[model samples]
Target chain A: MRGAVLHAPGDVRVEQLEDPRVVEPTDAVVRASATCVCGSDLWPYRGINEVTEPTPIGHEYCGIVEEVGSDVTTVRPGQFVIVPFIASDGTCAHCRAGYQSACAHRVGVTGAQAELLRVPHADGTLVATPEVPSAELLPSLLTLSDVMATGWFAAVAAGVQPGMTVAVVGDGAVGLLGVLSAAQLGAERIIAMSRHEPRQRLATGFGATDIVTERGDEGVARIRDLTDGVGADAVLECVGTGESMDQAIRSTRPGGGVGFVGVPHGVEITGRQLFSTMVRLHGGPAPVRRFLPDLIDRVWSGTIDPGRVFDLTLPLDQAAEGYRAMDERRAVKALLTP
Target chain B: MRGAVLHAPGDVRVEQLEDPRVVEPTDAVVRASATCVCGSDLWPYRGINEVTEPTPIGHEYCGIVEEVGSDVTTVRPGQFVIVPFIASDGTCAHCRAGYQSACAHRVGVTGAQAELLRVPHADGTLVATPEVPSAELLPSLLTLSDVMATGWFAAVAAGVQPGMTVAVVGDGAVGLLGVLSAAQLGAERIIAMSRHEPRQRLATGFGATDIVTERGDEGVARIRDLTDGVGADAVLECVGTGESMDQAIRSTRPGGGVGFVGVPHGVEITGRQLFSTMVRLHGGPAPVRRFLPDLIDRVWSGTIDPGRVFDLTLPLDQAAEGYRAMDERRAVKALLTP
Candidate 1:
């Protein structure tokens, strides 16, 4: 098998690796149909996160099951499925409560940017589609593995309701999909914060009612102006920086909510500010397993096409190009066909 | 008129003050029937919070309306009413959305421990009872002004539901009342965390199914053990310290909720911690005015006896002794009569 490995910062290489096999009774091997470079992947590539050793790196993938262990029941060979990044036992209390990321016995699936990958807790982590999907449906189906589901989680956590005016802070893939999720959830209006023309267009395509290009305090003022000085009813913080978090909180109405899905970095929130605003705060590494089935169904039905977030594509042997394109801002996301 | 003033930390005196009158069209003057020393008041009385000047102190009161300005409508002269500690206009966007504490025009009534108080936003901040109550009902009625209402807000914010297990982190007056509030809200099992004998007895009397005397890590471990290793479904954080906040978060199951109503001091929360927990955090100063009507009715009907939290009674001239008793933990609460 061939896979992408990081030997050092900014040094990703496509190299030959041993094929994965079902080592545990609950494990299964999946042949990668499509995978992508995640924004989080850039953290290590930029030397901000440590890469202690050469390691196989991707956690998002959707593909056909190649083999299943004796204990597997729900999915079988030749079936297409979406894999939640965090694998879990479906019977755990946290999993039962729709928070699989915090499941009592959980495993993280990595090395997905390869021709084949082994998945633990197969029966619990993989959601099989009704049938094999067409080639054109692969990108959208692949997104259900992480980014799209995370965006959907943010919208749900924010309490996006019918007739709500929602504001999304961040112009990345997650933010764009958040606009789509809010639209599907029946938000009356969506304010997308972005200065880039292309991302703004993508946001509008995803049903953003308005776009505010300003950043920080000026951006908050713009949202307030648009909402008649009342601020948004729900705000999605898709960037983990201190400034974005502050802007998101300040742009929400006094009794509104802020659902943040960004992996927070260098952000500190004082209890006084949170208490005075009375805004509900909910976020985390998304429990993608909980929302997988429904999201896959939506993608299969063409209700939303989140695959548009993938602006670049490459062959499995050229995986390094995928990372470089995303790192240089030349691509919103890069899809790799294995 | 006479009121309590803080000459310095640990120095409270009953002194002559100018009589209060309805100065604004939206104001009203009330002759206080009962005012009490609060757990929050002890912050300054103990010298932990600075007392830069001889400030008039107390924020909770229930009284008879003696005069009303021309614009006052809902509450009139000669009516018995519960005046929430924070006065709000009741018509602002926040007030309309059930967050009166964040109302655009809000005033904190700090001189309630006096013979008379001039309350602004009279029509919005005061909830008039159906009729004047007997002396025996005054204590409970006065509680509707702050502590009881604040406790009820904690329970509601924590999302307490029938058949759910709830845990309270503090055992102060508000914490005791929180137990009562959770019981009223239909929580099947209530766990009160306290070491004091009297407070534990009161908690059990208020419907606490279990009492854990442990604090911090051990306390969280005990709660998890009691909940089948999943932690409580809802945790009310009544103390604002970092340790209390951390315990409250760790004691909640993933996807659970925490309602913290303590006046936050020196509490700092990192976004990473909050994001990783996936716990819903809702809290702040209680919007007592929003719950005043229902709580007043509950007290009037004898359905609840929150006033039992006040274990000491003092005449207006002995206000210093009232503060001293609370500061020394000799009394759970001090009720004053003019």
Candidate 2:
């Protein structure tokens, strides 16, 4: 099997590796049809998060199950499925509460960039589609593994509802999809804060009613100016940086909510700041498994096209190029085909 | 008029001051029937929050309107009213949305321990009672001005729902009332975190089903052990400190919420900590004005008895002793009367 491995900061390589197999009864070996470079992957690539060893990378994946452990009941060989970024036991208290990402017995699915990946908690973490679809639907289905579901969680966590004014901070794939999620949730107005032309256009295409080409305090000011000085009703914070988080909080109304899906990086919030803003804060590693079923349905029904975020596509052998493209901002997201 | 003035930290004096009058068209002068010292007052009295000069203090009062400016329509002379701690114009976006504490035209009410208080935005800040009540109801009604409403806000912010497991941190007047508010909101199991026997009794009387006598990590462990390790569904943070905030966050389930109403004092939260908790956080100064009408009705109807929190009483001239008692934890709360 060929998998992408991180040797050091800014160094990712696709090389021959041992193939995965179902070692546990609750595990499943997935032959990944497609995988992608996630924004979180850039954390170590940029040296912000440490890369101590040559670690297998990639967590987003959707494919056909090649084999399953004896205990796996919901998914079987030949079934098309989406594997959540994190595996969760469905019966755990947190998983029962729809927070599968925080499940008591959880496992991180790594090395999905490989030809075959082993996903644990098969019945609880794998959601199979209703039969295999055409080649084109694969990209959209793949996003449900992480990015799309994460965007949906951001909107849901922010309490986005019909007739709400929403602001999204960040221009990444997740942020773009957040605009789409807010639209699906019936947000009355969507403001996308992006400085890049390409991401801004995608934001508009995905249902952003307005765009503010600003960052930091200026971005907050622009959002406030657009919302009649009342700030947004709900804000989706897709970038997990301190500046983006601050902007998201300040851009929301007193009773508004900020659903932050960005993995935090150096973001420090003082009690007084959060208290004074009076904005509701909720965010974390999204429980992507919880939304997989519905998201698969939406993708199958052609109700949403989240796959458009894949602006760059590469063969598994060019995995290094995929990482380079996304890291250099040459592509919104790089999708890799097995 | 006799008023309480803080000349320095720990130095509260009862001194003769100029009589208050309706200064603005939206102002009303109320002759206080009762006033009380608050936990927040101890911030400056204990020198945690700096006190710069001789300033009139006290923000909780229930009184009879002695006079009203021409613009004051909702409240009139001779009517008994509960003045919210912060006066607000009811028409602002935040106010109309039920976050009066964050109202654009908000005015902090001070000098309430005096014979008369000049309340701004009278029409929006004062909730008139159906009629003047006996002296016994004064204590409870006065609580609506601040403490009681703050507790209610904490519960509301935490989104207390029927049959949910709830926890209240801080056994002060607000935390105790939070227990009562949670009960009124139909929480099935209420855990009151307290070490003091007196406050524990008050908390239990206010509807706490369990008591945790630990603090910090031990307190979090106790709460987890009590809830089958699932944590509470909703937690009311009545004390604003780094320790209390951390405990409240850690004591909630992944999908749970923390409603914090404590005035923050040197509390800083790292993004990594909050992000990992996966708990919703909502809180601030209580929009007491928004809850005034409902809280007053609850007090008036004998549905709640928040007044029991005032364990000590003193004449207006003994304001200094009232502050000292509350500051030294000799009293849970102190009632001041003319």
Candidate 3:
């Protein structure tokens, strides 16, 4: 199988790798139909995070089950499925509470940008739709596995409500989808803080009522101006950096919520600001599995077409180009068909 | 009029000051029957916070309304009332949402440790009982104005559930009452992290099922041990220090909530840890006005006696001693009879 592997910081390659098989009782071998480069992959590619050894590269995918372990009951061979970014046992206390991302017996399914992948806890982690999605809907359905679910988590965490104003602090795929999610959640107003023309246009199409082309203090000021001097009722921090975090905090109302979905890089929230400002903060690895079914339904019903985020597409053998395109900001999201 | 004034750090003196009068159309002058020292007051008294001049120092009080401004409609003259520490116009959007502390027309009502104090937005800031209660209930009712309500906010924010394990981080009146609040909220297991004998007893009396004497990492480990290494389902952070915040965060289960009512001092939250751990943080200056009616009813019916926190009582002239005792940790809370 061909997979994208990170040998070190700034070094990514598409190479031949051993095929994955169902080694665990709850595992399923998936023949990936579609995979994509994620924003998180840039962490190590940009040399911000250390890559000590060659490591598997993607975590988002939609695939067909080639084989299933004996313990996998819900999904079987020949089924088309969307694998949530996180694997869960489905029976743990946290999983029962609908926080499958923090499942007690959870494991990460790596090397998703490959021809084939092994998914653990298949019964809990994979959701199968009644019909196989066409290639035209593949990218949109693929997004349900990670980015869409993450955006939904940010909206839910921030408690976006009808007639409320929501601000998204990142211009990446998740942030763009966050705007869409907030709109879907009935937010009266959506403010997208982005300077990039392509992202700004996508944000507008994704239900952003207002666009602020500023960053940090100026961005917060712009949001406040649009909100009549009061900050947004809900803010999604989709860029995990000091500036982005500060903008998120400052852009939220005193008692409003800041849902941070971006994998934090150098961001820090001081206790003084957190308590004094009284903004509620909730985030982490999103419980993507909990939201997969509904998101898949939305995609299937054509209510939301998250696939528009993928401005570039390539074959599995060209995974390195997908990474490079996203890294260079030439594409918002890149889809790879295996 | 005589009031308790902070001339410098560690210097609280009962001194003569101008008598308070209705300064606005919505103001009301109240003749305080009682007031108290708060844990937050010690922040400035301990020299950690800069005190520039002789600042009027109390924010909690219960008193008789001596006069009302022309615009004050709900509260009239000669009515007994409990004034929330923050005076807010009940008409504001935030106030309507039960976040009166962040009300648009907010007024700080300190200098309550005096014979008379002017309360702004009297119609919305003061909650009146049927009539003046017995002297025995005065202290308990007075606590509802701040500390008690703050504790209740912590519990509510932490989302305490029946049969769930909870941890209260702080031994002050607020933290002790947090244990009581958690119990009232139906948490089956309450852990009060404290080393102070008096506070520990108070915590036990308030329904703490366990006590952890350690702080920070050790404290978190102890909480986890008590909960079978899963950590408490919710943690109430009543102390604003970085250490207390960290302990509260570490002691809660992944996806659990940390309701922090503590006025954050220097605590900081790293984005990486927050995202990986998946904790929800909620807090701020409690909307005491929102809970006053119910709490006052509870106190009036003898269901709760939060007055137990005030171990010492003194005349208004001896406000200095009350401050001294609380500053030295000799008293959890102090009551001053005017």
Candidate 4:
């Protein structure tokens, strides 16, 4: 199998690797149908997050199961399934609480940017579609593996409700989908903070009622100005940087909630600010597994089209190009097909 | 009039002060019947929180309205009322959202240890009882002005539910009443984290089913050990120090919440820990006014007795000794009478 491996900063290659097989009774071998480059992947690719060795990348995937372990009963061979970024045993206290990201026996699903990948805790981690999805629906179904589910988690955690104003910080795929998620949750108004024209257009297409081309304090002021100086009812922090997190908290009303789903990097919050501002803070690695079933239904019913986020697509052999496109801001996301 | 003035650390004095009068049209002059030294007061008294000038010390009070400005309508002269530590205009967005402590037109009610207090935003800040209350009910009613209300806010923000195991991470007046608030909110098992025997007794009387005598990591471990190693469903952070905040966060389950109401001091939260832990954090200066109506009803109906937290009493002129007792931990709370 050929998988994308990072040898060092700005160095990615599609190299022949040993094919994965079921190592445990709860494991399943999936032949990748679709995988993508994530914003989080850029952290290491840009040399911000240290990478000590040549590591296999990618954690999101939707594929057909080529084989299943003997003990796996819920999903069988040839079934189309969505694998969450975080694989869980499904029976742990955290998993039972719908926080599979923090499951006791959690395993991060990596190397999905390969032709074949092994997913552990198969029975608990994989959500099979009702039927084999057509190629047209594959992209949207693939998003359920992480990005779309993460965006949905941000909205839910922020307590987005009907008729409430919302603010979204960030212009990436997750941020764009957050605008969509807030719309699905019945947000009355949504302000998307974006400086790029293309991302701003995508944000608008995904249900952003307004856009503010500003950064940091200025962006927060813009959100407040739009919200009658009271701030939005809910603010989604999708960038995960200190600036984005600060903007999200400062853009929300005193009693409003801030749902942050971005993979945090170098972010530090002052206890005094959080306490004095009185905003409810809820975020972290999204329990993508918990929302997989409903999200699959939404995709199947054609109720939402999260697939539009993939502006660039590449063959498995062109994996390096996919990473470059996303890193250089040439694409919102890149879908790699094997 | 006379009030407790903090000239420096350990330098509290009962000094003559000018009488308070209704200055703003929205102000009301109240002749205090009961005033209490708070945990927050010890900050400046101990010099942890700097005091540049001779500052009037108390913020919690229950009194009879001696006079009201023309704009004060909801509360009038001769009415018996509880004045929340923070005064606010009821019409602000924050107050409308039940977060009066963050109200746009907010004012801190100070100088309550004196013979009279000028409460600004009287109509919105004062909760009048049904009628003149006897001395027996004064202590409990006075708590509604701050401590008890803060504990209730912590419980409410933590999303306490029936049959859930809750933890209170402080042994002060606020923490003791947090046990009571959790019980009133239908928490089935309440764990009060305390090492003091007397405070533990008060906690058990307030419905604490268990008491953990450890602090820091050990305290968190004890809470986890007690809750089947999964951590409590909700944790109330009634102390604002970094240690208490850390313990509260570590003692809650992955998806649980921590309602912190302590006045934060020198605390910093790393975004990585919070992001990875996935705990929901909500807290601040409590919107006491929001719970005033219901709490007053509960106190009046003998549904709760939060007044038992006041273990010491003193005449108004002996305010210095009241501060001394609380600062030295000789009293859980000190009630001052004029």
RMSD of each: 1.0, 0.8, 1.7, 0.9
Docking quality (DockQ) for each candidate: 0.84, 0.88, 0.76, 0.89
lDDT tens digits, residue span B177-199, model 4 = 99999999999999999999999
Q: Which lDDT tens digits does candidate 2 get at residues B30-67?
A: 99999989999988888888888899999999899999
The CA lDDT of each predicted structure is 0.92, 0.93, 0.90, 0.93
Q: Chain A in model 1: its TM-score?
A: 0.99
- Candidate 2: misplaced stretches above 4 Å? none
The Cα error of candidate 2 at residue A326, in Å, is 0.6
The TM-score of the first chain in every model comes to 0.99, 0.99, 0.99, 0.99
Write the candidate numbers in order of decreasing DockQ: 4, 2, 1, 3
Q: Top model by DockQ, which number? A: 4
Which digits, one per residue and each the tens of the lDDT, describe model 4 over residues A236-313? 999999999999999999989999999888889978998988889999999999999899989999999999999999
**Which portions of model 4 show Cα errors greater than 4 Å?**
none
Which run of 10 residues does model 2 chain B get worst, by summed lDDT? Answer: B266-275
Encode model 3's per-residue lDDT on A122-151: one tens digit a residue.
Answer: 998899988877878898999988999999
Output the worst ten-in-a-row residue range by lDDT, candidate 4 chain B: B108-117
Candidate 4 residue pairs in backbone clash: none
